[model samples]
Target chain A: MKSTLKKAGYSRVQKQMHDVFLQFTSKVVFFIIIMFAFNLFFAGHYTPGGGFVGGLLAASALILLLIAYDRKTLFKMIPIDYRLIITTGLFLSLAVPTLSFLFGTPFLTHQHTYLQLPVLGEIPLHSALLFDLGVFLTVAGTTLLMIALIEGEES
Target chain B: MTTDILVLLPIIIPMFAGLIMLFIGRRPMAHRVGAALTGLLMLIITLWVIIRVYNSGTMVTFIGDWAAPFGISVVIDMAAALLLLSTTIVTFAIVVYSFQSIGMEREKFYYYPLILFMLTGINGAFSTGDIFNMFVFFEVFLIASYVLITLGGTKIQLQEGFKYIVVNIVASNFFVLGIAYLYSVTGTLNFADIYLKLDNYDGNIIIMTIVAVVFLFVFATKAGVVPFYFWLPGSYYAPPMPVIALFGALLTKVGVYAIARTYSLFFIGNSAFTHQMLLFLAILTIIVGAIGALAYTDMKKVIIYNILIAVGIILTGFSIMDQTATVGAMYYLIHDIIIKAALFLLVGFIIYRTGKVDSERLGGLIGQHPLAGWAFFIAALSLAGVPPLSGFYGKLFIVQSAFENNHYIAAIILLLSSLVVLYSLIKIFINVFWGEDMDFSKLKPVKYDKLLVSSIGLVIVSVAFGLGADLLYPLFEMAAEAFHDPASYASYLTEVE
Candidate 1:
């Protein structure tokens, strides 16, 4: 799939776009964003941070990498098709409600309980965590897929 | 217990099936087979529910075991079951028709999943008892439609799709505003609870009237009523035949359904004012649609305009707010969903075979595709309310109620629009099918068996639906009963607690 931008001969006339310092910092920024995104995701059930926000945060980190690197390197590093990611996220989300069907509960019924973890003592566990994970994956996958398509067109 | 809970299946099945289809990578044949099976499964489930609702009366299920009034309620009364049944049938037909007509490349681009999601939304819209939840389902389908309309990526499609989205998004904002107003006034999103609350409220009734009219504006835009219908004809014309059939048969009807649901259930307090206003707009809608249907020589626009006309007639019945008229609206709504789907599929097949949209360019298709020609004839008559066909009983009851209600002008226009419908379709039949077999560049032997089977299948169903109106009368009556006597519906909700 040849891009229109490439076809327009702008690639030859344009200046070399990458800056050395910016590239190194982007990698650092990507890791930090991913870590913070997970924190927000885990805290989402009680706090304001949930799947939708966390997914966007994580997707933005990957988008930074795409901006700094080429499509070839990006795909080589993470080879999963973006569409698959979206499907997986949706399945996970739907699975939670579907499980409720098996449990003889109503649709979208989520059960929560307290769990004793070896390292974490008493912790809250929720079926909605899986549902939120689905939302997170879907948001991240959809954002990145859209950006990837637009990036292909432009660069 | 599980059997009662099957109320959620109509919405759930489609989403689950579509996602699973997406999961299994793209194989065009697999997608077609999978989607066809899913549609069939949904059709069977809907039929069973419709029958059970007919025998047992209205059924309600609350999500997450949340009690009524506080949690989301999924209701399957006679009206909703009827809508679901027809929607599923049409969906099945469209899926089968797309097998032959929609190109493999496009099918590979997740067409089946889009169809499934749209089904999910349509089913959700029909079954939901919560007003806010209805808006959510509307978005689910509208988003799917945004992609379906522009699937081929034609310039016309993109342009039309953009306008279609803009119109709907703005309308949806109004939908939310209407909900907000209703919520503020009633302190409830549940339809049953709102019904109970609005009845007891002593506040200024004027605000409720404004909220009703605001909803009227929102739904009329979606249903393609006059003044707001400018975008409908163009948008409907841009999509491929199957997509067009889906929009023509289902989407606008969702709007019509919203109007009927809201008006009959919650907004009847000031009947004289709100219903009269509804009647006025419905008349104008029918007039504009009748004129537009005749104005177009292009087969697609004619059928598209006919969609608006059907919406008008159904709404007119709803606006009358009488037992007979409400039953007429429900019956007509079901009939229109089926017949319009059949008409669009038939029209689509012609365009596919002849490769021409204009009736002037096409000639003597009956000589080559006699089966399609005959099916279109039956569908046209059915659409025009010729006796014993699908459209007749609905229109007959509507006209009868219009007279009973002393809505003399509405009754007359309702009768006149039937003539326009007949003439417009016969014009297509005579011009396109009855001409001298004119040669065309794309007159190759196209494989049309799958398309024909599916489209003709709907034609068969329409005929059956018409002939079986006697047996179906009880179902239609029960559907109408809920509107007139809300005691059963209200009591059911009260009993839930």
Candidate 2:
């Protein structure tokens, strides 16, 4: 046992340690969750799903990536500042609502219509959808940013 | 509809400015210019809007074509406009002051954006015609303030900011709880609609009073009314000068505004009990706050405690709920916001100059910086409601109304509260500015020109507001009318569906 330990210790091992399963599962799950978030966001226009929940779901997917990898790698992959995301989200939410003011409508007047596309079937389109997108970005951004701040504080 | 859109501008403009600054990113000069311009624009817009409202009636907008009783509504009644006017003036001055005082580090680290965002919340809270919307705006500002209090990330700040956050979170929960209970009882959240629904509410009166009391408790905590004031001094002490000035100037007043609003609007169902309860609390708050001011030799604590005293006096007038008294309260409210912000800036400057907060360590600034010394003295006198300055007329009207209502004790206490205010403030003057001049050669130099300029501007407003009370009286009278007759403010709402 002592000879075997000395043999292992004396050897210069250059192989990198890796969480192969975690990396693979996280990559697969990230896309799946993102797809689900988009679906939820779109479905919010007519059904029970909406931007807030969709945003949270999307954030969780990113959080999963963060857990599997690390903050440095996750941020490198996304290359987006979360504070910018938050402010942009806020701007989007604010701008979308006030779009009515230009058209001589009271603030936040939403409009919707049914439309036919070249390949897709009939679908509903709404200003509220844009609003929901804003909400989605805001919730997602706020959650991730707060987590990042807390993490930075601890370190 | 044009005027209707103006109701949303106060909230929208500051928010848009804040976002634009965020997008601009890290340009200190640009941030300062943007902040100053936004502050100026707010002043202009509020002035214009107030003029329009004065000429016409209240401006009400139903967001997204939502009617007054159902969807989100924005109303710029006489009272809201007046409050907004005062708010803009204070914010503008603070913005200007922040240029020199709020250190470069905090400035680059999103200070202007946070201040503007806080402005957006304040304007929203004042103009929102929905109770639920008011709570949302409260959260909006409170969140900004949380970041602001911890802006520099100092140890004392973190400790105090934590307590501030905890206290506010609990108050917000109570606020939501109160709103929920009120909604459950009234079947509505719009202020006027709730009034309409509760006019003949066959529901239990006990539940209604309980809910009203709950709201009172919540706002009292926000406004730092006596028993609930434990967190105020410590939390306020934690931040930098400009941030503290912002808070002292505006935050507590929002709470005062909320209390005035609820009591005047939906809670009048049992004013005899509810208002009497308010009167008792206001008196108790005054007594406790005056005692606090006396006990503290620390400059900041003395000024912070003065805020509580001002709140008590304002609410004392409001509790009477008469035409004269509401006018008095509104006058005093505006006056207090201005003077308190000025006093805070002045005191903050003193602390910055001396690197000392205890009055015992500060002395005879009058010999060196006579302008600051005299500014503090005048502001101190004005704060005590000395006649020929801004604070006197409000106190006079309050005492007159109290005597008219035969609440003789309240009147007497209010009268004596002024004396206490005078004594406490004068004590600071004597201790800090009256004795031998502190050794200036040993003290580090500070850039006092701009700081003095900004704070003195507010002091001038207080002086003008007092001297030119006649010119402003019509606006205050209109506000008082709005207070007495809710229907005049309500009749503008166009029903939908």
Candidate 3:
């Protein structure tokens, strides 16, 4: 979360206007990206949008933040390590397949179940969703890490 | 279901272990112990699979309970099982060796995990019955190997890694392109299905030849055959000993195995042309490989070129395309896996002791490292096809089959290359292990009993393969049978139908 980036030579653009219009646009983009990613992930199993697209959306949000407020401010707001996120994603993806082994099923065989809830009627849960979430996290983490490494190297 | 589980276990075990290793805490000791245990478990599973497949005939397992041609399937024929077993053995030895030899920093950066991942890809490649799945598995191992080759991040390794990556990327493009051409004609990606459908598509001879040649180029690049082998020597010479040992033992063989599988199963439409091409390229491979070995003074380069020589021998046997030649190729394949790995490790040990890998700078290591020197001598002889060694029997069967088939020129090249192989290796042996001792003031002392033990274990297996050929011939026969008849192999899928 520390601001190791200095306001000097390697910044791609020095045109930070510090205007309210820019601030409002950034906030709107951030919120839209979050909701879009959520919708893409949860609806991935039965719908067109999936973990891969959702994770890419999440990465784009981070890039937007990087541009709006600079990396130092971005890091302060989101204090998560991309590498750790990558590891978690990797574990989640592997765990789903390994879990099938316990049930004496083939690796990566998905089992689905529906639960009748009070508010959300007949919500279907799938093991594949867990795999999708893993893909999402991994893609997001990897893309962000690559950006960070390239950015840091330049500066 | 039980058989399905067994087929799935070999590929899944290492994959799950590899992924788990990535998330584990930053303790190198735990990762090492975990990787070693994973390797041992794989060894046992592969051995069990080999035996089970031998007894039961070819067994096909459809993943996710879907039948063949519609879903991915794992086919465990005797040949595939044997390959899986040999690859697993070499991987286990390399894993154990890496524990002490690879530095802690590299291990911490997902080295063990990458090894397990590499094994997963290799096993998957060998077992999968689908051609596209083969490409998928190839990519898995390709990515892992790219990381492994450049893990140390030295100047030379980086240079070599770039070239290696570029070559593989280009080859992979051809792989996908060739697959597209194949699927367009046959309308299926499954190996058995494609073979069954080959009869229906009789008019596209030119397109089929193009597709087959493209695939042959792809595999030839991978196997480091003559025209495409320039990238292999520098890339292999760049990696560390354990990594190079793994590369020498398993990587190129995967390519050769793929060629054997596809050419036998599906590309029989133009065998006269295709097999002739294989023979011509194989002859070029042998000559270039022998000359490369003779040309190199660096110990590692010599070993690398020797690898190319083994490739030529195996391809020659494969191109002859008979049961005897197939068995000989299998024998030579397994033997080369063991002895080549042993040679690399032994040479690495010598380099560790002498602080240099070039032959001219090293001399009289017999006094200081007699065990390694003798191990090297035996392995070299084995590589050169001396009698009573594993390499000789492989050469014998190959030559016999060639003469029987009236391939006198191939038989001559096979025999002549054996002598050239002998000369090149003996030149290295005398130059490095005999004569006056080199100065040792700059040598760094590291304990090597553990490293030597693993290398010795490999040497023992290589020797056992020679001395126990009587006991192992039946197994080789079973493997050869799998390749000798494509009908029986294709029937594994047709059984349910």
Candidate 4:
């Protein structure tokens, strides 16, 4: 397939152009900033920045790296399995409500507190925020994994 | 004694499950574990909601200590709860069916989470007190569905899925706009609040009708009503069977549920105008759907078209707006969810076994797989509204309701459409299962594990509703009452806190 693409006059410069255009600018900083904006705007929703936006940001970052470097380099840098990211997100989201069940609160009844983290100072950890973060990670990881599979088809 | 968690459980469980599925979806074992656990949890939650509503009355929950107009709320009256229960059952069956059909290669980590999110949307639509929340939930489910529909990322899947995504996104934007206009006019998003406000605003009836019509078009697209239904067949035909079955069973019904909920609660006075429009659309939908079904040779495509038929009948029943008709529509909606899912799964099984879905190329499966053939037969019979099955009761109720309302022409069309549906289904049965034995020497006998499980589950469910009509009749009646009486729902929320 690589040889066929090469034979078809696919140049490294074109690839580099794509890496610069589609991957670097769109995926890394812009994607993250867009996600932050989405969350900040929709925070009135009681849940900050939804999972969908978060997922897009994370996935774009990975896709950018994949385009800038080779797949092998991309793979090595992200040594953690994509599945683990998704699973951990799922677990954290489920854990909050499941723990609420133990306390006799209805499922997803939000609980919150402020915790002091030496250098980070007091940070509020609302269960809803945790839920949102879970959504973000899962969306990001799963979407990246899907894009990876699609990109892999080229090889 | 305590506030009812039953109403809230369906929404919360699936949201939690989606979150968990996101994390655990990468491993097949973990995915299965997560799927099974969530399925069981949903089933239990549904059954518990049923029992609670049966014992104490409707379930209502408020969010963030806010009253109905001030904050988000969830309400599960009998109708909503019944739909929620059916959705849970269908989703559980589909999830179980997916275990075998969606092999590890395609059961990507995101699949389970997407399904859960899809369920969250369905449940949220069923239980949400606010219209805006319903729109939000609809978007949630819609986005998840777009992802699920295109899970495999085939060129065709992507092509068709893009159309599906674009159409739904447009509809959702329209839905948001409709809700904004509704909120501006009524000063509230809660269903009960809207209903109450609507009663006082007799002067702006024209504007109200226009908004209602806008909502009708938005939901019509979602429900696959005629003219707006073109996207359904092509897009649905692109997905894998399990996913298609899930979509066939649940997605359009959510749209129908929204239409039913909104019209009943807020637009009761405008039924005469709305019902006439619905009647026209419903008739067109039935004819179009039946014709589309006949046009398709592939079993999955035929089933997709038949789903549109079911949507039409349910809408037709709703259009009549009589109590009995509403009851019939509710019954049909539930029955269709079970039978259609079963039919889709069966077709999936056949495709798996034969590696061909075109009816013209397939034959003689009855002798080879008696279990599957028989299950398909029963499901088809139920779908055709044959006597002694659940399907008959729904049609019977709708027809009787039509006659009661003196809608002779509408009643005739309903019966005629059923006959067309029957013929289409029979064509499939004869072509795929009974005619000539196709060569199977080269093909290994495919295991119909998920098909068998879900088929049996659906068959038993349909039978229970059929044989125990008396027992289920009151449930349908209760659903009708819940829909008709907005006060009961409104009072419950206000009374709760």
Q: Estimate each model's TM-score.
A: 0.95, 0.95, 0.94, 0.85
lDDT of 1 by residue, B90-127 (tens): 99999999998988878998999999999999999999
Order the candidate numbers by lDDT, best to worst: 1, 2, 3, 4
Better of 3 and 4 by lDDT: 3
Residue B100, model 1: Cα distance from true site in angstroms: 1.1
Off by over 4 Å in 3: A1-24
iRMSD (Å), candidate 4: 3.7
Where does model 2 exceed 4 Å of error? Answer: A1-18, A153-155, B494-497
User: Residue-wise lDDT of candidate 4 within A93-142, one digit each (tens)?
Assistant: 66665566566665567788889999999877677777766776677777
Off by over 4 Å in 1: A1-16, B1-3, B440-442
Task: State in Å the error of residue B213, model 4.
Answer: 1.5
lDDT of 4 at B301: 81
lDDT per residue for candidate 2 within B358-414, as digits (tens), equals 998878888877898899999999999898999998998999999999999999999
In order of listing, the candidates' clash counts read 1, 0, 0, 9
| Residue B341 local lDDT, model 3 | 93
True contacts kept of 4: 0.24
**Which runs of model 4 end up more than 4 angstroms from their true locations?**
A1-155, B1-3, B442-444, B494-497
